[model samples]
Target chain A: MRGAILHAPGDVRFETRDDPEIIDNTDAIIRMSATCVCGSDLWDYRGINPVSEPAPIGHEYVGVVEAVGSEVTTIRPGQFVIGSFFASDGTCPHCQAGYQTSCQHREFVGAGGAQAEALRVPLADGTLVATPEIPSDELLPSLLAASDVLGTGWYAAVAAGVQPGSTVAVVGDGAVGLLGVLAAKQLGAERIIAMSRHEPRQRLAREFGASDIVTERGDEGVARIMDLTRGVGADAVLECVGTPESMQQALRSTRPGGGVGIVGVPHGVSIDGEQLFYSHVRVQGGPAPVRRFLPELVELILNGEINPGKVFDLDLPLSEVAEGYAAMDERRAIKTLLRP
Target chain B: MRGAILHAPGDVRFETRDDPEIIDNTDAIIRMSATCVCGSDLWDYRGINPVSEPAPIGHEYVGVVEAVGSEVTTIRPGQFVIGSFFASDGTCPHCQAGYQTSCQHREFVGAGGAQAEALRVPLADGTLVATPEIPSDELLPSLLAASDVLGTGWYAAVAAGVQPGSTVAVVGDGAVGLLGVLAAKQLGAERIIAMSRHEPRQRLAREFGASDIVTERGDEGVARIMDLTRGVGADAVLECVGTPESMQQALRSTRPGGGVGIVGVPHGVSIDGEQLFYSHVRVQGGPAPVRRFLPELVELILNGEINPGKVFDLDLPLSEVAEGYAAMDERRAIKTLLRP
Candidate 1:
């Protein structure tokens, strides 16, 4: 099997690798149907995040289960499944409380483009949510989206406490941010301001139900949001970018008694507590409990309520996986989907 | 009129001052019946917070309305009133949203202590919530407690999202923290943990419905809380101390999907966003919206649902107010109530 591997910072290669096999009683193996390069993948590839050694890369995948171990009761071979970046047992105390990202038996699905030709999944019954049937070919990209980005955006909106008639602001215009616009809309937010400078992504944001778009960055962006809401700020702010500036912008865009749901993968960020205290804005965000929202997002996509597959700007064969990474790293793509 | 003034750090003195008179159409002149020294007052008194000049001090008060301006219709002359430290125009957006402390036209009553024999209150009709009639002599202490400490604790518990059958933790052992234990119990939290070391406070916490007491501080305290909850941590944590250690401990003690309500006046504190992100804890705290909870707290006290007055350990005449500050600053008293 061929997969993408990160040898070091700036060194991503497509290479042949041994096929994965079911190892544990609760494990299952899947033949990858489709995979994608994540915005987070750029962290290691661009060397912003130091890659200590050659490491397995991808965590998002929509694939066909090919084999299952003895204890795997829910998922069976030949079923279509969508898996999240974080694999959760789905029945732990945390999972039961609907925080699967923080599940007691949680594990990161970081294997060298495990979403390539074949992949091994642990905690199979809990981590994988199978669709009713093998999804039609036309529904593949959207189903693949439920694996991470859409589920993550849904979590961000829910964490931000977006409600009917809420005025929401989304920071960052990546796939996650765009989908956050959709999520907030679906959650009944009356107004959504998407902060984006990119033309293509902003178009998708508008299509995703953003009522307005502010091209300003950082403080100016926050000022725009405040202005839009009559200087009171938005009721909910979705922070999808994990930078200090983005975090500050998100916090500033929310009114007192509002909330900021931060879904960004924070690297190293410090928040001034005094400012937060004075802002009176609630903060709640973490790794998206993707598994918690996977079922609903799958339904939304399957039922045609949201078409998040529009985020895919570049698509290619699994053999040209290197190009997919390059297009995203060089800012030519919003998201790159790889057909394996 | 006579009032208490902070001439310098550790230098509180009684001084003669001009009598307060109605300053606006909505203002009222109050003859103070009682005022109390707060834990926050010690911050500036100890020189930890900067003070440029001899500042008029004290914010908590229970008084009889001596005079009412034309616009003060709800409160009239001779009515006993319990007012929050911050006087808010109850009709403002923030006040209507239950964050009266951040009201657009907020007046800090303690900027110059209501501890004075006579004081002017702004927005009297809104700031002062009146009893049906002047309370009996025995209810004075308890009603005075509702002016700030008890109301603030109720705000913290509400902000923490403590629910019936939930396990809650109080992160400070001061008057507010002790009252928070009572509020949590009243709010129907199944288990209340008070983080305290002082014998007197521990006893008060127990009496106020604290089911467990963790004497450790910082990380050790968090560990103890986790141990008490069988390693799942508390469902809600009330942060009544604004210091970094207490704030972090409060954050750490909450479960992954729990809430932390912070009421302590934040000084100089910074939190690592990554740690907060990974923890998946919701953070909501700021100046207590005491005015919003004042009505309910008054009912609770009136009905004997709680007895927050027990937190007052020292009582002094208004003339000996300096002694009240000394008692609290030296940690010899949990709270000091001064009768004017």
Candidate 2:
């Protein structure tokens, strides 16, 4: 088998690797049909997150089950499935509460790396949700998105308390942020303001149902949101960028008694308790419990109610994995879809 | 008129001052029936919050309307009323959304000092909630409690998402925290855990509906809460202490997908963004939208359904204001009620 491995900063290589196998009775081997470069992956690729040694990359995938261990039930070989970055036991208290990412017996699915031709997924019955059928080639990208970005964006919107008639603001313009605009719209938000400086991303944001666009950053962005919402601020704000500035913008852009949903992987962010206390805003965020939303998101994708796959602007063969990383790193692609 | 003034840390004096009068068309002058020393007041008395100059102190009070400005409506001069520390225009968007503390046209009711015989209240119709009738002296203390502490505690429980059968933990055992236990009980929480080291406060907490008392502080406190909940953590946590330690304890005590409602005025508290992000806990805190809950709280107090005023273990005349501050500052009294 071959997979993408990060040897060091800016060094992703498509190299031969040991084939994935079922090591536990609850595990299953997946023959991946598609995988992609994630915005989070750029952390290690840019040396912001130290890559101590060569390691497999990628956590998002749409695949067909190649084999299942003896104890696995409800999921079988030949089935097409989408799973979250974290494999959770569906029966755990946290999982039952819809926080699968915090499941007591959870495992990071990216440990073996979904960027490979095949991958091992633990807690198969709990982690993977099968599609109604093997999806069409055109539906592949959207199904792949449900594995992470789409689910994450949807979680961000839900966590922000977006509802019918809510005025929403998204603090990042990345793939997840653009999808967040889509999620807010699906949640019936009456207005969505996307903060972006890029031309192409702005166009995609508008297409994804952003009612307004603000090309500012930091205080200016918050001020623009307040201005647009008649100085009351948005009812909900989605924080898709994990920086201190973006978090502050999201917090400040929400109306009193409103919510700020954070989906970004925080880097060096710190919040002043006093400021948060006085803001009268509710905040809830974490690694998206993608598993909780997978089934519904898959249904929506298959039914053509949503087209989250539009985030994939650059598609390439799996062998060109390094090029995919570079494209996203250089801002040449919103997201890169790689065919296995 | 004479009122309590903080000349400096530990220096409180009952001195003569100009009588309060209606300053705005929406203002009303109230002859105070009762005022109490709050845990928050000790911050200034202890010098944790600096007293730049001699300033009128006190923000909790229940009183009789002495006079009403020309434009005041819905309230009469002879009515008994309870008001929050912050006066808000009920017509503001934030107020309409049940976050009156963040009302755009807000006034600090404490600025003129609530400890005096007469105090001016801004946005009279928006800020003051009249009782059904003028009650006997026995109801004064309870009505005063609703003006701040009880309302704050109720807001904490509500913000923490307390619901039927919820397991709730309170992080402070002051008047507010003790009442938070009562609030949790009123909200139908099945288990109320009060965190306190003081025996007297602990007894009051139990009396207020705390099913369990944990004397641990900091990390040990969180560990005990987890142990009590069988390692799953409480469904809701009330943070009634503003220190960083208390905030951390509240956050760590809540289960993933749970809520932490904070009411304490935060001091020098900074939360690590990554820690909060991974916790999967929803946090909502502020000064508390007390005005939003005033009516219901007053009704509850009047009906004898709750006795939050029991927090005032020490009672004194208005002239002995200095002793009231000292008793609370030295922890000799849970709270002090001052009569005019």
List fnat per candidate, in order. 0.69, 0.91
Per-candidate TM-scores read 0.98, 0.99
Off by over 4 Å in 1: none
Q: Per-residue lDDT of A185-290 in model 1, one digit per residue for the tens?
A: 9999999999999999889999999999999987778778878998788989999999999999999889889999999988778899889998889999999999
CA-RMSD of model 1:
1.2
**Displacement of the residue B122 alpha carbon in candidate 2, Å:** 0.7
Candidate models: Cα lDDT each: 0.89, 0.94
Instruction: Assess each model's interface with DockQ, reporting 2 decimals per model.
Output: 0.77, 0.93
- Worst lDDT window (10 residues) for model 1 chain A? A107-116
TM-score of 1: 0.98
* Per-model chain A TM: 0.98, 0.99
Q: Give the Å error, residue B63, model 2.
A: 0.8
C-alpha displacement of B329 in model 2, angstroms? 1.1
Candidate 1 CAPRI assessment class: medium
